[model samples]
Target: MTVSLDELMAALTRELKPEQFKDYCPNGLQVQGRAHIGRLVTGVTACQALIDAAIEQKADAILVHHGYFWRGEDAVLTGIKRRRIKTLMEHDVSLIAYHLPLDAHPELGNNVQLAKILGLNPGSALSRQNNHDMGLVAQLPAPMSGADFAALLAARLQREPLHIAGSEAPIRTVAWCTGAAQGYIEQAVAAGADAYISGEISEPTVHSAREHGIHYFAAGHHATERYGVQALGQLLAQRFDLQHQFIDIDNPV
Candidate 1:
């Protein structure tokens, strides 16, 4: 069973509501590719390599976390940007991206998936900025030592997490936002989280963690966010009966 690009975009827009967000890039159908999609590829970023892989697979569409036409990016398509768009257009492969909507979705969101993986019983949004909270605040099923918690995160995310143990106290309340959201530590603290976890960290994050008495974990940004898009791809694959593959591009930062 094949789904047209227009049909897929309509379903996704209805589910994600890209219009509701003030994102860095255009949310849906950044590049018009094939008219009909029989195979889909999903990834964290729409990099050149991923595009090439999709081309190799003869993918009808590429779905990703990062796409083009970002707020701060150069609008004119040239250089690497032009090349990426040209490749997709030449192959008639559609590019559909979801940014914040992917992050904030209750069931299929990055934060929610991360919380589930970390064994946290999510309660509410850690911050109240967007319509829904950007991150999740959850209660740990049982208290665990900071070291043990770090070990758990490392095991689940498959990256050595940067752990800043603030106090000797165990962690029972946790908050997390995926993908380089170190700035949200304060918000997590405000949410009364004993610990905060995100993908990347700054030097000052150590000082903030120690002073605030909140354990901080810098899990890999690429690692923490891999689940949401994969889940979304699976759903789309099942719903549309399209072949789907999740291509992972390793990023140290």
Candidate 2:
């Protein structure tokens, strides 16, 4: 079975509701390719490596969370960008991206998926963007010490989070936003989260966690963001009965 590129795009835009959030990049099909898609591949980003892999896999479309033309990036197709776009065009493989929408989707979002993996029960939105929150606040099943919680993250994500412990107390309430959301620590603090987990951390995050008496964990951005696109791919494949594969091109940051 196959789905028209238009049909797939419409389904995605409806499911993720990209129009609701103001994002750094466009949230749907970024490149035109074949009109109908039978084989779909999903990945974290639209880098040259992922495109090459898609070409090798004979994919009709490559769906991803990160695509080209981010705000403030030079509009010209040059160097790596040019090579990537050219490769996709040569293969006639469509490139679809969902930035904030993929992050915030209620059932198949990055933060929600991460919460499920870490056994955190989601409670409320972490912060509002365009009147909808892009992250999640959660209640832990039981209190776990800060170090224990950090260890749990490392075990699950397979990457050691840089732990900035706020207090010796155990973590009961937590908030998390995936992929470079360290700036939302203030919101986590205000929510009374005992700990805040995000993809990347800045220098200022250290003082904020300590002064605010909340734990902060800098899990790898790539690691935290890997789930949503895969989940979306699975759903699309199941819905349309198209062949789907999630290719992981690992990144440390």
Candidate 3:
């Protein structure tokens, strides 16, 4: 009913293979807590809200997709950052996170999970970086209008994606990258995807999609990434026979 923090960290690192990817933040065990964990909480971000929710759930370790210590972020821990880390340390809760590794995972990645939810069968990788695919191209069972595809995403993700319908043609191929990967649309276009889906969209994305005639969907970053951490937590909970809870802290962006 309990697993050591080190042991859990090792297992996660082994499964995710963080060493294989170039990530912004450190992965696997950001903060040290009690030696053993009996309750685990997983979420999209390690914000104060998630930490508070984890404490309410009496979690021993908090696992997340977005952790602290980015590449160009201010090195000093202050304000919100200071408070978040303090809360975890005060409560003796460990913080474990996986970033690029979680996104690039073949079976349990965020893109794959989103594809599964939308009933899209993956056909090929869209962007290959560091010897791993960052996004995936999926084959729809049948071609559908861009509007229809956007509606399907809204229904499945429980959030209306900002759809930029580029072409009137029915879409049979879509490429998806979760969490602020709208920049990968070029790769999707290169792959001849009828539509491209990602968490966020930029001004350039609008022009690219319109000019290239590829549908673009800007789903919420938090909403699109909610599944991967939960899936990983569920697997670990089942494997270690520990209590696992996935807490969602709503974020509009």
Candidate 4:
């Protein structure tokens, strides 16, 4: 079945609620394409490779977690940026993206998806200081060593996370936010998490985890985020009966 680009956007907007959160990029539709979309493609980022893949797949619209025109980025559309946009325009493929909104969606967001994959039951917002419910804290069913928890992440995420030692005790509580959210370890500490998991680890994160007495894990940014878009794609497929394909472009970082 086919749906109008605007209709698809409306469905996504109603589900994600982009206006609820302050995001770095535009949430709904980034590029205009043909009016009706029969084939929809989803991916983690709106990169050139994903665009090429979508075009090859004859996709009518592309939904993604990351899109262009990020806040504080270079305003000029030059080099690769120009090429990506030009290719989409030339092929008449719609580019729809959701950033912070996708991450925080209570049921379909990245955090919730990752928690489901890791078998971690989300309890509360990771940071109590703010109203933004981006990350989540989960008390484990049973306490396990930090090494064992890292191994579980490795098995589930298919990538060995960078583990930083902090507390000697087993990890009973973990707070996690997917995709370049290492800075939230402080919030995890404040939440009284025994360990914290995020996509990227900065230099200061090591010290923060150590000094705060919390274990830290740096799961791959791309690895941890692969599920949410796929889940969203499946939702679109089920809801609209549109042909949905999720293209995963491998990224080491």
Candidate 5:
């Protein structure tokens, strides 16, 4: 079954509510591709490689976590940006992106999906600013050693996480956010979390973890975030009965 790009965008915007967000990049249709979409491709970032793969698949629409026209970025499209837009326009493939909305969704969100995959039960938002913030406060089924918790994250994310054990206190409550959000560590502590998890680590983060008596884990950003957009794509695929494919372009960072 095929759906028009306008209809799909309207449905998605209504569901995701991209207009309500102050996101890093444009949340929908960064590049206008085809008018009628029969096949869809989903990925983490709208890089050249992912776009190429979508083109190869003959995808009419490409959905991703990161898209163009970021808040602070140059408005002028040139060089790599120019090429990327050119490719999408030439192929007539529509580009739709979701950032914080995808991360904050209860069922199809990145943080929720990460918790489910790692066997943690999410409780509430760690940050009060946005109930839909990517960071979440969760509780473990039972207390686990910091080492064991780190190992569990490693097993699921397929990367050796950087663990900074705070107090020898057993870990039961935790706060987590996917991608580079080390700044949220304090929010985790304020939320009464015994530990915090994010995608990247900074030098001060280690000290902050130790001083704050909260364990900190740095799982690979890309690894921790691969699930949400894929899940969203699957849902869209099933809803519209369109052919959908998820393209994984590995990023170590």
Candidate 6:
């Protein structure tokens, strides 16, 4: 079965509800390509490597959490950006992206998927943007030391997180926001979480965590966000009977 590009876009719009949150980039169909998509590719970012791979796989459309045209970026396409867009156009592959919507989706979001991976039970939403929750507070099955929790994150994410311990006590409650959400640390502290996890850590995060007696973990931004797009891809495949693939391009940061 194949879905029209418009149909796919409408489905994504309905599922992600992109209009609810003010996003850094446009939420859906950043680039137009084939009208009927039978094969779809999803990735964390719409980088040149992922686009190349999708083209190699003969994908009809590419769906990603990160896409071009971020707000305030130079409107003119040049260098890497130009190359990426040109490649997609050459291949006749549609490009679709959902930034905040993908991150905060109730069931298929990056936060929910990461929690499922680490066995964390989600509690309440946090960090509201445009009246929509952008982050989540969660509970571990049982209390564990900050070090133990860090180890669990490393084991699951396959990357050692930078651990800044603010308390010596075991972590029972945790708060998390994926991909460069270290700014939400204050909200986590206010939520009375024992530990906080985010993709990137700013210089001020250390002081905030220590002052508030809450642990902080700098999980890799790329590492933490590799799930949502895949989940969305799988759903699309199952829904439309399209051939879907998720290609992960490595990024240390």
lDDT of 3 by residue, 66-135 (tens): 9999899998989999999999999999999999988988888898888888888898899888899889
Per-candidate local distance difference test: 0.90, 0.92, 0.91, 0.91, 0.88, 0.91
C-alpha positional error of residue 122 in candidate 4 after TM-score superposition, expressed in Å? 0.9
Q: Candidate 2 on 45-104: residue-level lDDT in tens?
A: 999999999899999999999998999999998899999999999889999999989888
Q: Can you tell me which runs of candidate 1 are displaced by over 4 Å?
A: none
Candidate with maximal TM-score: 3
Question: Roughly what TM-score does model 6 have, to 2 decimal places?
Answer: 0.97
Best by lDDT: 2
Model 1 per-residue lDDT tens digits across residues 95-176: 9999999998889999988987877788888875457779988888889899999999988888889899987899989999
**Cα lDDT over the full model 6:** 0.91
How many pairs of residues in model 6 come into backbone collision?
A: 0
What are the models' TM-scores?
A: 0.96, 0.98, 0.98, 0.97, 0.95, 0.97
Off by over 4 Å in 5: 130-133
List residue ranges in candidate 3 displaced over 4 A.
Answer: none
Query: Which lDDT tens digits does candidate 4 get at residues 160-250?
Result: 9999989899999999999999989888988889999999989999999898888999998999898899999999999889899999999
lDDT of 3: 0.91
Candidate 3 matches the true fold with a TM-score of 0.98
User: Where's the lowest-lDDT run of ten residues in candidate 4?
Assistant: 125-134
- Point out the higher-scoring one by lDDT: 1 or 6: 6
